[model samples]
Target chain A: MALKAPLAYETKHHLSYYECDATGHPSLSMLISMAVQVSEEHGNSLGLDTAAIQSYGGGWVITSYEGSFAAQQPINGEEVILGTRAIANNRFFALREFWIQSADRQVEYVRLTGLFVYMNLQTRHLMSIPQAVIEPYHGPEKKRLPRLAKARELKDVRFKNDYHVRFFDIDSNRHVNNARYFDWMQDPLGAEFLTHHQLKHMTMRYEKEVRYGQTVTSEISSPYRNENGELTTDHRIVVDGQLAAASTMIWYE
Target chain B: MALKAPLAYETKHHLSYYECDATGHPSLSMLISMAVQVSEEHGNSLGLDTAAIQSYGGGWVITSYEGSFAAQQPINGEEVILGTRAIANNRFFALREFWIQSADRQVEYVRLTGLFVYMNLQTRHLMSIPQAVIEPYHGPEKKRLPRLAKARELKDVRFKNDYHVRFFDIDSNRHVNNARYFDWMQDPLGAEFLTHHQLKHMTMRYEKEVRYGQTVTSEISSPYRNENGELTTDHRIVVDGQLAAASTMIWYE
Candidate 1:
């Protein structure tokens, strides 16, 4: 039997100019910020504030995400509705979905899918989703969590350099913006290399979530052969040698 | 002698909601977005593109500014310092000042004292400030820009309400964050009483600047010795207007 997904809390956020990307629309990192916000509110509505969860010696972490962008995102100052729902739960994993809509027409702007894992804060080891956490969501035990897009495999995934997390990297919500990962993931490649190549397609899979005051050391390495006999690259954002996010980018010459 | 003030080309901007006030920030009627930005990057030292500045009109317009604040007022990531120079023309007043900072510190921040005036777009009523806009800064021309602030004579003042502008009320340049003025100046009064107050002291002066979108506003009005025995309740930001910011709280309860 499938457990009934809980209707998580929803919030309305007004887009700010600082949230927009060079495309004149909200950047992908901003969407993740909204998702993270709604998820926190969802937990709060369930009486699971981070402090309380930490008290239990367990904390929530994002394991992976498979999100989709429907169209150009909202512009600054536009009110957008953010909705999050608890979709599924298992011994070690929980699934959530996020939706963003414009205030005027309630038209969808972006939809996101995320996977969360419970972990021991002290040990940084994965923990089973406690029965108490799952019971509140009214979810069932029989349904399996959906699979994420597998990170592209490469023969020469080289570990490049490390990045230090700065205070400005944290937002009002206290976590780094998701899009910032792209910066860290790309920075090691050198500014000249980045300027010379354009990202044609990129698929990022988040394996874990890093929090404030945590210096996430990223390891990026990409090596691949394209159909046209050209070299390609796959990247990884790792925190202390653990994979946090992975991406495969098709570059423009 | 005022050293030659920075000479920069004019630029443009578009206003966003985050730049607006819930109560008194820029009102709907005064929603000209790009003008302030043009002034901030007037010289375009940060490498702004021409294609971006050509929107709305060939020129940017700043209608008026009411107040000022100290350092720590600017918002995060805001591009500033372009519009800090004044033009030679009196009608196209170029009110400009830069943020003061101590030595040996990296120039991470600056405050721009901006002066603006209104002009007709179609007719170019005031027209553009020509080469002489640089005159005042070269040396005090014995010319005085209109004062934005003067101490109110408390005895004869009759204030219907107090005024306030919050920390968030100021912008990145820190001068009473311009966005806050809309809500600060207008929100204290009511729809029924809009016509009663002829603003003579709209000039707000800066002492210590508010930082990063803090909720603040100004408290103002002519003083009155009322029936409550020296009772002076000009105006307060009541929830329904009950002293939200910069309110005058009497201890005499």
Candidate 2:
């Protein structure tokens, strides 16, 4: 029997100065980390913690993310709300929604959704979602999950940077942290572009896990206008000529 | 007249998994960051915020840090208490003490002290501490502040690694974060040593600030036993053959 729980969970967080960038806004990586943290709390509230999930011989792995950011981003030292909800899931896939908002609910800073899959811990192979793990969340069962925006393949690479994954990059899961990919994906845009533009929307897909002691090349296409006339940039992370992850970002002045 | 404020300030923090290392303990860098956050809160509580201090044409800058850690450390998802108090200050130098302990106050995780000096934001030279800033803390005024352990000069360097400062490394202060030095100082030791050993004590001194787009060379001496029969390692961060920062760490199995 599933333990009854709230369909959604929310928590308050105080943004620290170290979490913000030079522009005084929360860095994208930190924002994503906050989202992940909230989701972990949500799961723990439902009594489905890492130990419980891994006991079924698998652990949740994020495959892709799609999100949008508002122009008025949260600043350092501000108290904000982090919320997450399980949207829908199937045997092989699960979808979750997340948001970051002002404490008074006056402003919406970020809205994101992630696609997840269960992976066997020892065999490193995809596994079906465990009944005990997914039951408590009470997400609707779906035969097919909604498709997220796929990262367009990188073409006409205009800039490239090589980053050697350091020991600190690996988190408790023993692989490079999922949120860290944002730093590598956008850093090659250089300080000038990063400072002048604000990220409005982003879509990222992870095809391979980056490990410690690996040098990954971050490649990006020059900023161009989309059909909606929004400035867009395409990014891809490659390791040893193999695509590790790819992302597309829409920016505004 | 100074505003009446508590001589010490304390706050509770929930340690996120991302802040911990693969060993399931808070990383040295994150522990230092937590201490810094608590001090900032302490200053803010006394109405000595950055703006208030910077109005005098300078800001507080850390010159050195010395600290010790307990055998039992806090783990991810644990709620811990962070506390800070002004120890003593002079016209040009100030010293602050910090600690991290269990919520129930049964176990002490870390105890640290930092030496600080006011620096002119424009001239980047030492400046006398402003009365408005120091008076509110109610710390005893002194003619000479206690000195912290100085980092030993690196000798017989056995291992070295190069790290490129990324855009994310620069915080709101616009320089590499003070906590980041710990990562650079210790990463060259490799994962095997880091996982098998725990940091028992550390002393670090900052000589120069690292900026964005700079590649730093982190060099370290082989671990050796000190006179107290404790394993100790010496580390230095160099940029262009110039010493930027240095540290000494004592570890226990």
lDDT of 1 by residue, B78-196 (tens): 33332244433353565644332223223323333335443344564645444333342442333567544332322332333333222222222223434444334444444323323
Q: For candidate 2, lDDT tens digit of each residue in B1-253? A: 8745438989999999789888888999999999999988888888878888889899999999999999999988899999998888988898999999999999999999999989996678999888888887778887888888877777879889998898898887776788998999888888888889999999999988888999999999988888899999999999988989999999986
TM-score of each: 0.48, 0.97
Off by over 4 Å in 2: A1-6, B1-6
The C-alpha stretches of model 1 lying farther than 4 A from their native spots are: A1-5, A104-107, A154-163, A171-179, A186-203, A206-233, A238-244, A249-253, B1-253
Instruction: Say which candidate scores most in TM-score.
Output: 2
lDDT of each: 0.49, 0.90
Candidate 1, residue A62: CA error in Å? Answer: 0.6
Candidate 1 chain A, poorest ten consecutive residues by summed lDDT: A165-174
Deviation in angstroms for A86 in model 1?
0.6
